[model samples]
Target chain A: MAKYLSKLSKSTRSNLYTVTAILAAYIIFTVLIATGNMSNLLQGLLIQIFYYAILAISLNLTVGILGELSLGHAGFMCIGAFTSAFFSKCTVDIITITWIRFTIALIIGAISAAIFGAFIGFVVLRLRGDYLAIVTLAFGEIIKNVINVLYIGIDQSGFKFSVKDSVSLNLGEGGQAIMNGPQGIFGTPNDTNLTICVFLLILFYIIISNLVNSRSGRAIMAIRDNRIAAESIGINITKFKLLAFTISAAMAGVAGTLFSHNITILDSKKFGYNQSIMILVFVVLGGIGNIRGSIIAAAILTLLPEYLRFLENYRMLIYAVVLIIIMIINWNPTCIAWRKKYSIRNLLSAINKKKEA
Target chain B: MSFISYLIKGISLGSVYAIIALGYTMVYGIAKMLNFAHGDVIMVGGYILFTVMTSLGQSPILAVLASIVFCTLLGITIERIAYKPLRKASSLAVLITAIGVSYLLQNLALIIYGTETKFVTSVIPIPTIKLAGGNLAIPGQTLVTIPVCIVIMVSLTVFIRKSKTGRGMIAVSEDKGAAVLMGVNINKTIAITFAIGSALAAVASVLMFSSYPSLTPTSGAMPGIKAFVAAVFGGIGSIPGAMIGGILLGIIEILGRAYISSQLADAIVFLILILVLLIKPAGILGRKMNEKV
Candidate 1:
């Protein structure tokens, strides 16, 4: 294994390690699940963990790779969730096959989110750093608020949309109010399962990892490091940024599709500022720009609160404290120096030196 | 007549936002970091006031003072513990720490307060002013809030213009390295900015809860965000800009609620922010920042 790793390029080697670790975890969890060793709570959380991991990785493309701070990722996810859920609700009877229906919903979700991403990206080009972060936050809140008041229904004539109350939708005979504004959509199909989630997660991971290693990825990184320098060097900052942002938004939408399908009901309130911040926490804590780190961090942090259910009231409090401590340990200069000095590599090398002596 | 009353009510609400925006502007001007936890400080102030007036049976004035002092101390402590160590770190790290602190404060409040909505008795003793044969009646809270906002803004402007420490803050904001070379105590100046900003937040809490009455752990969040929008609208680093921005935002919000759907009022406010940023990124009063290699 060591010899083979040495033969491969550095990026390929890292990719191998990440993929292998994920597969290993997947195999172990599947075995445990098959043997009925996994608890009910853990089993229920599996799909949620997978979606959150996907969200984190997608967010990493913007925050870590693109070198921007976005506080509205959940907004994109919310868009994806609502649009796809709407599609599924409308086509429930027309689409006989569940898998085909779900596949279309996923596509719809991704495409809708990507469109929003492109629009937001257009506005995003005018701002930088903290300003960009704030605008994105504003946009996210707007999306949520707008969704809250939206009323949608379908009649024999066609689909009806109204920002007013459900009565304003004015349906004909056999017409149903699919989305009842604030009450949200009901009866979304529970098509999400652990196997499908894990499959999608691996697929997204490969897509993102490959994108990161491509030439477009380098241009995005260049813009992130130094916008002026990148522009001066003939990189099309606008094109690359919009591309990355749209892709990231699309992935977030996919995560949203998975989320909405996994549950029986969907509410726009779930895609609030708090949810966005929670995903950001996953991205930040997982080590910014590190894809593998994002996955592991999202998994651990998502599971931490669930497992800490024993802590009761202290669960969130403990979570907050852990968040702070982890940030300090990860980013503090002195801590970084200390970590460098006492890393496992140094320890192993010291042991070998001692043996030689 | 109702329109006139709505205008007054809008001004009053805007005054509260102006106060909160002042805090945001000051901290941003000097520290150059968004103190996301600033909103929670307002909530903390509200809780302190509630405890003092209701539980401790204190006078309203004393309660207000106690809240201000506690919030000031809280702000300073937060800067020292959570933010100071990360001063040399990336903006991303500082931002994350601020967010963590915000969550910590919110969760701590949740643990202590148990998510119950606390109704705060009005501390302002001013009587409601009735006019135009009872067609217009402005609440006592509005009477107190608008004047208080004007007074704070004036004093804040004067202090920044005349005081030595205030000059230090301006110096630091202009260029940190240059300010340090000029013998300004960078840490002390930053701490003072936080103290002053958090103090204004406490005042905003008193005025806000007096009018709104209901207090919750998340009460400060929406107003905090709107005030931030106000700060940005007026041009972030300018004091006068915050006041103007706050009042305009308040009027817009009120008018939007009255004429447009109340549900979409927030959306309108945020939409305005996006438009303002696109058209005038530096804001109404903000100076254009030049990039240097």
Candidate 2:
């Protein structure tokens, strides 16, 4: 451990510290679950933490890295959840293997979300700041409302989609309904588990981290820092913005698939603007532009409600207070310089000096 | 409902939206920040009126006056507490703080009023007006709403155009530093803008919940968003544009609800916003300005 720590750059070493701490915690929790020591409620929280982490990381790309604010992250997640859940429901009898079915579902989810991301991002990304924020928010609300009235079913003939009512999906005796228009697509098979969730999180972390560290990532950040400067240097503004938004959407879609498989039933109401706001809060609290911060924020906030069960009704109120405090702490200039004084780097350097003495 | 009746309903709803959207546009025009908690002021207005009318047994006129005064104060307080510190902060930070204030208000209402819907009796006591040779009917509330909206919009425009205080607001919104150099009381102008905008919100909520009396903590949320959409649909910083946008949004929303899927009303509103923003990024009436390099 000492040898591994000795030769690395300070930033890399600190990042390693964050990664190791999260990993160690996860490992310990997994053991507790395996031994049946953890509560059922906490076990459920594990799946949520993974998916929320995926969402926060994806949002960080557009919000933190790309410097675009989106109030419609849940819109992409909705498309993902409904599409993948619907796909899984229809193919239940035909596809026996859960793993294979989930793989196909994830791919479909990613593609569909990317398609939507491209369509919306292409239009809205042309503008910047408040306009982009509002349009994305509108998109999210539109998707949620549309999903409320959407109906789909499957039968011997093939797949069918309807909007008016469920009865319109006339089918054979063995026909099955996936989404009954506002009733939501129910009867989804529970294929999500700790292993799959952890795998997805790890994959998301690596992809997002690598992207943030890449040349394109630098270009993206450059555009965010100064649009005209980035443009003067001949950076293709639209291309990179589109790339980041599409990738972010695709990742959210993957998270949505995992989310659907984890939950017993899927509903449009679950993916409202409020849900999007909550995810944004996670990104903000996690430390904008910090992937490790996103992971930790998602985990803690997702589990906060369950842990604060005794506080019950006051939990969200308290959560609001915490959110304000965190935002103030993060942005307040005096607090920032103060943070540097107590920051881990300072603490580490102090410890090293003591060791040398 | 006949096309005309639907149109009326749409107009009335549009009027409510216009009043609310005007508040949004004024604040945006002056402060250069989306006052997310602006909608909550409407909710606060409704509850205040509800308490006055129901609890204190005050007359409708008294209740409304009280509501306007209380909300105006509330708006000024909110700006001073939540937004003042965020003046030099990034727009995103201000935006987030605005949202946090929104959540704080909603949850506080949840705690105080509880989760159940609190019904408020209609403020407009007039009977329904029937047209189409006595075949079509309009709610009494609708009749009151349309005129009130028109009055508010015209007066607001005149206020912004003719009044020195209003001109100060425009100057501040244009460039705060320049306004300061020009001897504009930047803080006072911004505070007055908040006060006037919030006063309008109180008026809007009272009228909005008159017909739709199923009030809850979340009642302001949807209207708040739709009004924001209206503000954007017109032009973020333009008053007349907001009025036109609010009315058009009402018509579009009502028509969609009646002719298309009723459940897709919200979606239709948002879709229009997206389409408008894509085609005319500056909005229908918004002035286009070049971003500084």
Candidate 3:
């Protein structure tokens, strides 16, 4: 078995490994779903894992690769969710006529978010490091507050208009009311299926992985390593940064669409400052610049609390402790250096030297 | 109350922001880090005071002092554990670390305090004082906040300008390498800066809680970001500039809410930031530093 594994080409081996992993995951999910005893709690947890994984990977494009700290990625997500929600609301037969309207909503959401990302990038991309982070943070907060106040629902008396209108839409009786003020938009269509979400996620993962391995990704890495040397080599920092930001925003929009449709409830609070920080946490905890690490981290973080259900009220505390431990381990240079110093190659060479002696 | 009364209110609120902004500016000036966790530290201080005030049943002044001490220790510890190690790393790394620490702190608070809003009773008696024009009422809390802010600001200015340690801080902010060559203790100075800055944030927290009296885990997020904006608006490294910028921002926000649509108030502040950046990227009081090629 070992000889056969070693004989396989690197790409073939990796592809086989990925296929096996996916099959295993699918089998496990199917078993869990089929089991009558498992609660909706597990199902909800799995969905959240998939959702946050998309968000973390999207954010990692800018933060981990481009080496820019953006506090406004959530704003892009907000734009995407709201855009898709708006369209889904307008069309009644959303689930059946999915192909055309879904594509349009997704495109529109991506384009709008990308446009906003580009505009913000042009303005604040000049500032690097901490300055850029603060500006972006403020930008995110401003976007959230603006969305909060902008009335986007149909009113009663058959009047559908914005908050600027004189007559307000009275979402009568039931919770099926129009986007309530500050309460957030409700009754969005839950058209997101697991298959579609998984397919898109895998597609994004491949694209991002490829991009990070390409020449442009190398240029971004170079800039991240040493700005002066990269600039001296004639790399256009601003252009590349803007590209990363726009792409990241586009991906975030996709995630937003998935999120809005999956939950069927959209609120301003869902895309607030905390959500932005949460994405950042996932990226960092998963090992920055490591896409697989981010994916694994997102899945684990989303599922860990669910698994530790007995902790109950102390769940967050346990999560915090685990995070602190992980951070300490990651940040400790001595441990990393030691591992590098005493690798299998070193052990093999040392054994050979002793045998020769 | 007259417009002047409104002006006073603005100034008072701005004074609090200025105090908070000073912490941001000074730390950034020296470390060149955004300290995303700084505002959360302020929130932690407020929570500390709330705990002390509620548990010990102590007087307001004593509770405030205890909270400052608690926050000062927290600030120093955070610097040592999270930031000090990343000092040599890229500025972005430090910022990420700051964010992580912030999340850690906020979640810790959430775990400890739960997500409920804690109400704080006023420490100082509410005093209604008449002013010129129609009758302007001033809360005793506001009076205390203003004087305390002035005293701290004045003392900070003096410390930075006059004392040797303060001069060492200035030198370090100006040039870390050169300061080290000149026999400055870089770590000590940095730690001192964090202590002072955290203490100022503690003061801001106490004042804010005194006036508003409600505290929650996420409370620090907005004020922290706004204070950072104030720091930027007034030229990040300049103290007096932060003071002016904070007051100006406060007035703009309040007046914008009163006159214009309440919905557009936040937008207006952001527009101001954009306009300021376009017009004067260095900020109102900030001197443009030439980038080294």
Candidate 4:
């Protein structure tokens, strides 16, 4: 086993370690829950942590790997949440098998978000940097606001859609409003569980990590490092940018599906600029381009606020302070210098030399 | 007549946006970073005015002046503490720090003031102007805001074009390295830009609260983002651009609310912004910048 592990490349080994770590964590938590060793509060937070970590990973693809600042990630999540919730609600009676129904809903959500992502990418990719960021932000707000005013119902005549209020939906006898405008969708099956979320999380991680290691990933990174240089080398800038963005959007959609399924009701308000910023916070704090760091940061930051519930009014205050402090430590020149000089790799090398001496 | 009234209201709202956009444009011009906390500064300014007028029983003039002074100092302090250390960092790092500062300001406000919305009394004492035999009565806020916006815009333009420090700002924005080579104090110029921006935020706060009559910790957020959109619309880093963008956005917002579904007005405004960005990426007044190899 040791000889086989030694033959694998460093990247593959690291990937193996990540997958094992995640699976181990899932197993340990499942055992804890099964044996009644975990508290209800902690158990409730488990799925949310997985989804937020997924969000961080998705955002990291755009911000960290692709080198684009997306301020409207929540918009794509909104599309996923609403679309998935709408699907689940409409098909609950039709599709009795719980797992099958949820699998379809997840696929629907991801595909819809991917479609929107491609459309937005096509338009916004023409611009660069800050302009692209603002356009995305605008797109996000438009999605949320438009979703807020969208009223959908199903009757004998088929699906009825209205931008007006629910009263205008004018449902027939035995008909029901699936989406009641600003009130949002109610009774979305609480189908999300730790098992599915963990599976999806692993799947997403694999996809992103594999993408990053592939030739396309190198092209994307080249575009990020220097767009002009990448273009000079004959890389299809639009195709790669759209590919990364669409995949990122689709992953965020899956996360949104997880979120919607975890809750009884899904509102567009949950997917807004603030949420986008929060996810961005996760990606930024996690160390840009460091997949593992994003996961760790998302997990810790998501759990921190819940744990700090003891602080009451001061919870957010402390959270903000911690965010600022972490940023400084991570990015400050002096701190970076300090970290470099005493890094674990250097320490390990030094210990080897000392033993040889 | 109602249409005229709505148009006036839109103009007034646009004026408020113009002021806030000025702050954003100026900071972006000199410092080349989005001051996300600029909106929160407006909130702070509103709170200051509320405390001064209601809590401390001060006059409106005094309240406005006090808010401006406090916000200016706040801006300078924020720049010195949070931003100064990040001058040479990546733009994303700076943006995240700005967001952290924004969160810090918001949470701090939450701690100190709680979540209650403070209804502030209008500081501008101008009475409603009854035009055309009371058929179109312009509110006092509009009467004051439009003139105030015009005066501020004109004077600010002059300041940038004529004043020594203002020219220093232009130099810094034009070329940071060249500015330094010419012995321009980059730090001082950036700090002053922040100060001016924050001071404009305070004025915007006064005008905004007077018209809207409500203040919350997050009240500044939407407007701040809108003003940012406005800044980008007019062409980021251009003073005149910020003004036009703000007014245009404000008019569109108000008109969209009045004519279209009020609920989807924000959507319409944003949609228009997206459409405009598609056609002209740099914005109406923004100069076209070419990437150099």
Candidate 5:
């Protein structure tokens, strides 16, 4: 373990900086929680922030690394949320044995979501750009509608077997329900302990960071940059894209499982296209393909609405204005020109190629 | 006999979708970007018509004209604000901005109009005419909608084929750099395209509201998506192709719902899209342009 750690440290070289930053963040989180001045509402709000952050990071895996735009990611989250909720409500023991149930739920949810993701990836991953985006969007809508219909079960033998009446699952009246149709499933057991959730989130961050730096990650990046070129060089674009998508979907499922278990509620509306877009916003606003940037952007955007509560009726307007400003700044010609002129890495790479030749 | 009536009804419904699909196709043809907010602009047009009809208590004809003007202005505004800045950016950036604009418009409508569905009275009279063994009844709105759509489509075809600005728009869509070199004002042409497309959306909205008198803030989302599918089905950047695609999609959706399970409506449409994409990625009416890789 020590040797591995040393090797990791040597490879990263900037490990100390990251470690210190993480430690500082942990300290700050603890301090904020310990302070009595922070209301329970604020704490709950922070938990929600962390939940979305996990989702955003997971989605970034596909959107950033694979360079594929999936508008239907929320569908996978819905699958995860529903599957976990169904299992957790299967027996009282599962609910009571919180920690074990949580772990089991995450695993099951992730696997199921990954399977679904792989299935979709096999079919739609062949398409690129706008075609992929539209198909994914359609897939998401289909899932939502199907879930909506299936949630209300058929009448059986005079005894209506609704999601609510399913035996072994007793999450109060609302909790046991699979998905309460339009009203959404309620009584979800809030088993996501804050510390564990944060820890899992950090773990995911590490995994993604590692994946982005690995050989497989480089191959995925190459595919994104030039698919035809990558394929010509013996890189299997289809295989790598599917792998990335599956991993990303699994991460999203994990996030959804945590969310469902934590919030104790599951709504199809919560997993709609809007939520998918919201996650995409976090990825984009944070500077796509940048892990640190994605995390920070997710946290800030998640928390921004809460801080802007005072805006009241004008909150949406203010939000729109802010978005417009960000877009304008990001699109400024001067900024583009500067980036193009001073792209040192590209220049250095050019020089290196010349030297090698 | 009723089958014939259903077919007519399907055609009328398809016509509305075709009108909306034109906007999507034209903008995509010139811009190569899916204006996700285009449907919301239709919603905006509906709301404007609603406001005009209610406040002024004017005739439906006048209200529709007003709505068209409002939609044209809104379209121009959207181009100026949301799309103009990202004209040179990557397609992804423009697509995201389009989504942002869509959300912004939907939420704005929600705030302004409230979440509750608003009722709009039918502007066109419902009339019945006997044809075969059964009576063939066509909504007066269909008569108006069909003729108006036909007129607009024909005029647009003529404009695109003959007029200098229309030719300029086509030229830009074909080759932006060459068109610019030939003294076509790209910005002005783009703005004009948006205006024309949005105005068409407004007309469809008015007709749609007449057919179904309830309006909600998010009503544009599904219609917008369907129109997009129509555009894709015909060919993304083809004008007449959009019309054909829209009508066909409408017929398929309505007939599918009537004949097949209503639950399968959305699935069938998406299935068609996927199948089309797999078979002919350039779309049925769309010509394939070879890319220099």
Candidate 6:
């Protein structure tokens, strides 16, 4: 009985939920691919599943765990996408080794996004609550517009930069244009696959869940749970906030690299206020502090729009209805009381007892 | 001359923005929530007005009244259904609920209005006012938007000053518990605040879409955000401050387009927000409050 109890408790550990969910998802995906059950549409959506999952997890760190709201995640993602897209585009011919270049792209993307994150975090992390949301949102918008008007090119003379028009890059005789203002980077690389995505997803899961259970993560949560109490205990609010924010930003950037490499042509419009808000929605709906909840929420919501495609224009209306209903069910007082009364733990224990009898 | 005309247009645009800002500022003042859906409510107004005017060929006044009524009802309904339950919930919870409401509204508009942009017919027939020997000309829409904004602002200020419900609202914002103990119906006051704010959004939406000559599902989003910035700029809860902030923001945005690269206007507006946040988090006209704990 004690052995059974210990095993039950090990499997039921809450942080391990992400592990369980990912494994289940991976198995389902593999089976679908093996049996050829996944349609092309769903296959395409798999990329979104991986990237959005990455985005939601990273956003959850700041919004759910760090007790801060950041609306600029898409901005970091944008920086990552552009950095890697340009890197890949410029080096596609220069670097003969495809795997090496992809690895370099990931490193460069992560570092670039982290640098931007550190810059933005330093400016905005001093503020508390809603102010952070607003600043991050503004940063996301600024980055989108900046990217639209920027131009980059590479040739024998190395990289050249201009704005407003790509023609102005004025690369040498054999220069190749990497980015055209507004048009974004066209004809980059499409290297994203379920295998890479799953591997990266696992890596992301390990990093985030570990951080959540770490000493630094505890201190960060202390600040969130009670700023004054945490301060009394001698936690440096600024350092931790910056650390969580920059790391979250770096992870989002890695997702961006994955996303950009997946798509043949990258458009700046995809990484905008709407995307940021959508990611935030995923975090919020995922029960804030629940890592597994974020993963599940991102997966479900990413597939929802496509699932409702049969409804066509009305799908969005249905989407809104679903949002309101979910909040009502999850946040309603009566529902909360009912859930507590019929708690999962009690139900599980009852089943165990019945089995023993 | 074109520059001067842009300035005038900017002011008119700012006037419309002011009316919208009034909605956000008042709601924040009383409800103590950012009311993220206030912008989406403006879209609702535009769609309603667009449908009524285009479908029924109703008189402009009728269209306007319909919009106002629809938004008022919407504001109340949103408060009762989504927000009332979460009144005691955490700030993040309330914020999420507010966003859900926003998504609900935008998606609803998308369903009903379709993905296409609907051209909004002008309600006001005033001719373009030419000045500077015809080098500068202001559209007739400006005439209606600016004057209407002034009239609304003045009336709102007066109503808040003398009216009983207005006083009740003031008391509630000042201190919710005290207001309730003093015989103010907290729910009613909150409802009325929402009604008035949403009514104001109706006017702003009509002006916004009509000026741009088109109404899309996302017609109100940018303007809505800009107006919120205006509300914040003016010291979120201050009526007069919202006015100043809206007008200044409109001018800066327009001039930014005229002089600086048009693409960077949003960046500039956001930069100003950050600078203001860094320098004065409470905003220019906002009274600073010490943190309680």
User: How close is chain B to the truth by TM-score, in each candidate?
Assistant: 0.98, 0.97, 0.95, 0.98, 0.96, 0.97
- Runs of candidate 1 with Cα error greater than 4 angstroms are A1-4, A351-357
Model 4: share of real contacts kept = 0.67
What are the runs in model 2 whose C-alpha is more than 4 Å off? Answer: A1-16, A334-357
For candidate 6, lDDT tens digit of each residue in A1-357? 557545754424554565667778888988998899989999899888888988998999998889898878999999999999888887888898888898899888899999999999999887666566777888898999999998888788788889868778878898877888788999877766787788788888778877877899999899889887898889998899899999999989989999899887787999988888888888888889777778778889999999999998778778877887787778778877888878999789889999999
Superposed by TM-score, candidate 2 places the C-alpha of residue A255 at a distance from the truth, in angstroms, of 0.8
Compose the digit string of candidate 2's lDDT tens values, residues A1-357.
789788887756765676677678779988998899999988888889889999999999999999999999999999998899988987888999989999999999999999999988888899877788899999898889988988878788987888888888886789877897777988789988887777777777778777877899899999999999999999999999999999999999999998888887799999998899889888888878888898989989988777777887777778777777777777877778899999999999999999999
Clashing pairs in 2: none
lDDT of each residue in B212-263, candidate 5, tens digit only: 7889988888888888888888888887888888888888887777886576
Residue B140 displacement in candidate 4 (angstroms): 1.1
- The residue-by-residue lDDT of candidate 1 on A116-163, one tens digit each, is 999999887678877788889999999999999999999999989999
Cα shift from native, residue A134, model 4 (Å): 0.8
lDDT of 2 by residue, B1-293 (tens): 49989899999999999999999999999989888888899999989988899988999999989999999999999898777766777777777788888888888888888899888878889899887688789999998899899888888888888999988988898889999999999889989999999999999988988988888888898888889999988889999999999999999999999998789888888888888988989788988888897
TM-score of each: 0.98, 0.94, 0.88, 0.98, 0.89, 0.94
Candidate 1 docking category? medium
Worst 10 residues of 6 chain A by lDDT: A8-17
Q: Could you give the DockQ of candidate 2?
A: 0.63
Q: For each candidate, what's the DockQ? A: 0.74, 0.63, 0.41, 0.78, 0.46, 0.60
Ranking by DockQ: 4, 1, 2, 6, 5, 3
User: lDDT of model 6 at residue A356?
Assistant: 100
Query: Where is model 5 more than 4 Å wrong at Cα?
Result: A1-23, A152-180, A335-357, B1-4, B126-136
- Model 3 clashing residue pairs (backbone): A155-A169, A156-A169, A156-A170
lDDT at B76, model 3: 95
Single out the weakest 10-residue window by summed lDDT for candidate 5 chain A: A152-161
Which wins on lDDT, candidate 2 or candidate 6?
2
Candidate 1's DockQ is 0.74
